[model samples]
Target: MTIHRAHIAGAALASALSMTSSANAQALEYQNTSGGSVTVYGQLNFGYLNFDDGESTTDEIVDNDNSPSRVGMALVQPFGDNQLRFRFETALGLRSSSGISQTEVPDGIDWDRTNIRHFDFAWANPNYGTISLGQGSMATDGVTGADDSGTDVISNVSVSDIAGSFAFRDSTGALTGVELSDAFSTFDGGRRGRIRWDSPEVANFTFSVAHGTEILDEDADTDYTDLAVRYGNDFGDFNVNAALGARRIQPSGSDDEDYVIGSVAVHHAPTGLSFAVAAGSEDGGGDYYYAKLGYARDFFAVGTTAFSIDYYEGDDINGAGTSSDSVGFSVVQSLDSANSEIFATYREYSYSDGTATSYQDANATMIGARWKF
Candidate 1:
């Protein structure tokens, strides 16, 4: 297995693209005067999502709700036992949403495009490990996650993906008048502008650390530090992966806060059975719990067919005594021949306030297809 000490999604897409020698989707590779080469690769994925606010529902196309749709390039140069690498990547919002709008596009311009997602440099030595800098994931990013469920491409209990576009109905069946806030979970902390380091694995254990600032406002008087430890091993037919991480944020004009998160997942390859659990808490007044169980089988000629159920509960978000509960189920079918997948999911979300009064609830259903090149 190839070890990816960089961005998780990047590594996955790169691996998928590397297997295809198709003339239509070929990666541009160049050999430099030095012992080095550069490769350009990317993937595009989109889905149609329908969200219900109890009284009404709307459907729209969205991008990266599951597997992100992006394009990127990488440069690698070998120096004896060590290597130097650089990567540049950006995402496509695809659909017009609050986060990205097409209305402002200049006439004659088909697309205005989004900003770069990943721009980083790294140095790696098999014996000494790797160090990276720039806009990318922190060491603790995804460290609180342990989902072996194939449905992750469609649903993983992260409510924000679909909930953002719809409103939630209060207990009395009244609209909150605002878009439902994204689901809360410890499975957050995506990419950021940071410096990170990964230590070589020893006895199936590896360590990582990072310091970074929020992506949008780097100059904000806020700074964050993240640290994590990871474990992976195979015992007979059982494969296990576990991670623990902690983060401290010193926010501008606010009291400092810290958080701890951990997760473990186990899978039986021969039987196609898997399970995972995760929990986390913040120093102030917030906590979350998540669990998922699933199975995968080669029921189709194309690839494996998988299904899973996931649950999440979060409390006192940002010290507001706001709580959320979400339950989701999904089915995913992979088409190996085309390097793509078809998935469908159903989710129910509930929210409450500090007084234990029901705040809102909503439902979402999505059907989508994704392809990686």
Candidate 2:
């Protein structure tokens, strides 16, 4: 199958390129300085492209290859007599991320900087709440959906878009696309500048709400809104977290616009087990769900191998008219956090009533070093 070959190819590619080493960067030498401060951190991942879903997300490479990886910096400074604060994070490596198209997918895209990997500023102690601004993911973005589907736009679903997906379609089948939740992608406020609030939690439960105004070119558009509630706790050997989230777009009009997502996760670490369930509504009018179960233990008590499994499905697309499911597993090994091995994942999808079907899986083996200051 196409999906199977893609996985194997990507794996072979990753295996060949996985031979990597990076000199350790000195740690952030904090002098306990008084005024405002700046901090930075990022990672670079280069590997073979062995994925067989017959759907190469970015580019269809023949075998093992080298590629650009993630790199970013965070900056913070105080202004306005300590009343105002600004922070911005940007990147050149995100082209390989899940939210947007990378040069990796065959004959893929080329993006320029200032695409705003992320930017936000906060003025604290405001009347309604902390006034903030940015094009980053809003409060409900991760709370209600699959937050880190490989931390890449091509692999994850965007919670803000009415379309709610990054996977794209080619003449033969479906291929993954950039996060697509970006400012220019679609739907007002789908991904835009906004401010939000945090109602101090009571009885261990918290509340948050945020709204954005889509910048349709320099003209701007109607307000986009997101609202949600969250709850979590750990008692004895049991731990739990749950979130109920939703988003409504172009509040000014009620045409074909709407999306919803819900999620719950639990862990029983004593037994090395965990589970998660997430569901969403993208139908402009329908619904869907994704789930996972995982277990971990030292393979033969050597601390060299670990494993997990994940399953996913989406239905009643935010208005796209499609539905599908995916299941995956991963193996990992570590000699301390700096040096580790990761082998992951398989996902397959069946379209509406067998009208269409596509499969995708990833096999990545990497050995790298990381040092933080």
Candidate 3:
């Protein structure tokens, strides 16, 4: 909901005058106001997952393998023709398999944690651009794997939210006792406490930059910097968008790493077809690649239906000579009336050391739903 500052000011004056006049019957709602409206919004997502690592199989309910559930509030206040915006959003781990109290949930995790997603203030002008400060997304948050494929909800480059729980096993189905390598991640950048600025789009192009002390605590804390550029435009029935990003991470007690990431996506509105590809390489002989193809159209009376296939591979992570590969397919159907989606997905994963011998192989299938407001 949005309310003008002028109207709120007038209401406050009227309310003050009404209070002074004891006989007055009418009362204004805004007795004290700073002039802005806050809108609350959120999403709830969960999936029933059946996972198999050859050795064993498990079925359970998980949250946000497709997208993390979150709730947030946004405040918009106009200052003359321009405006100031404030946002506070947090992820909600609705179901905890660990059985820990909410207060005890650890911070900085994307799943199964009440992590603060954004707490930032921004000043924006239609012609000038936007500047943001405080805890928020860095310039390249999702730039590396920007995709227009409608099936990104269930098939994309990122790892599943519950990936941490998937353990690697030997061919005999015996627990190789080795946890999956962290190299599986695609390093698409993420939210951080930082200062960022985005240049107003010109000719369908925008540029951004940011610097922060610590973006994610997953690894050793680092001083980080990122720069990115994005382009979007339409040519006839074909829509095209792409991004290029670079990040430098100076780890506190480890070797510094620099990465260059690029992504391009195209969508055809008439045929409801889409395709995207993303790849990144780090300075220390580490790299990743991802690709997705999808098609979507209104197949049912309710809403649009989408299907897609995606593949990802990472090699020589941080000089550890570990590699990972994944391939998946998904179907998603939107329910416009309920602001929700019904989805099902299947994926296969494989891991290997520097040697060609397979260390682990796993597969999973999931059926899920997501609601947004």
Who wins the TM-score comparison? 1
Total clashing pairs for each candidate: 0, 47, 0
174-285, model 2: which lDDT tens digit per residue? Answer: 5644222321111112346777665556677766678877542455556767777778888788677887766777745446456666777777767767676777664445
Better TM-score candidate (2, 3): 3
Model 1, span 1-373: residue lDDT tens: 1112123554454466443222333344545566676566666566676677666666666664456666677878899999999998776545522232111222211233235677889999998799999988888888767778787877664555644545566667766644544446564556778999999999999999999886655466778888999999999999999999988888989988888988898999998999988888888668888899999999989999999998888888634767778888889999988878888888887776666445656777777777765
- Over 89-203, each residue of candidate 3 has an lDDT whose tens digit, in order, gives 7777454222211123333234522267898999988888899998788888888667777777667777444444466776665665444435466666688889898999999
Q: What's model 3's overall lDDT?
A: 0.72
Clashing pairs in 1: none
TM-score of model 1 (CA atoms): 0.84
C-alpha lDDT score of every prediction, in listed order: 0.72, 0.45, 0.72
Which stretches of candidate 1 lie above 4 Å from their native place? 1-35, 96-115, 177-183, 215-219, 318-320
lDDT at position 242, candidate 2: 81
Query: Number of clashes in model 2?
Result: 47
Ranking by TM-score: 1, 3, 2
Lowest-sum lDDT 10-residue window in model 2: 179-188
Candidate 1, poorest ten consecutive residues by summed lDDT = 100-109
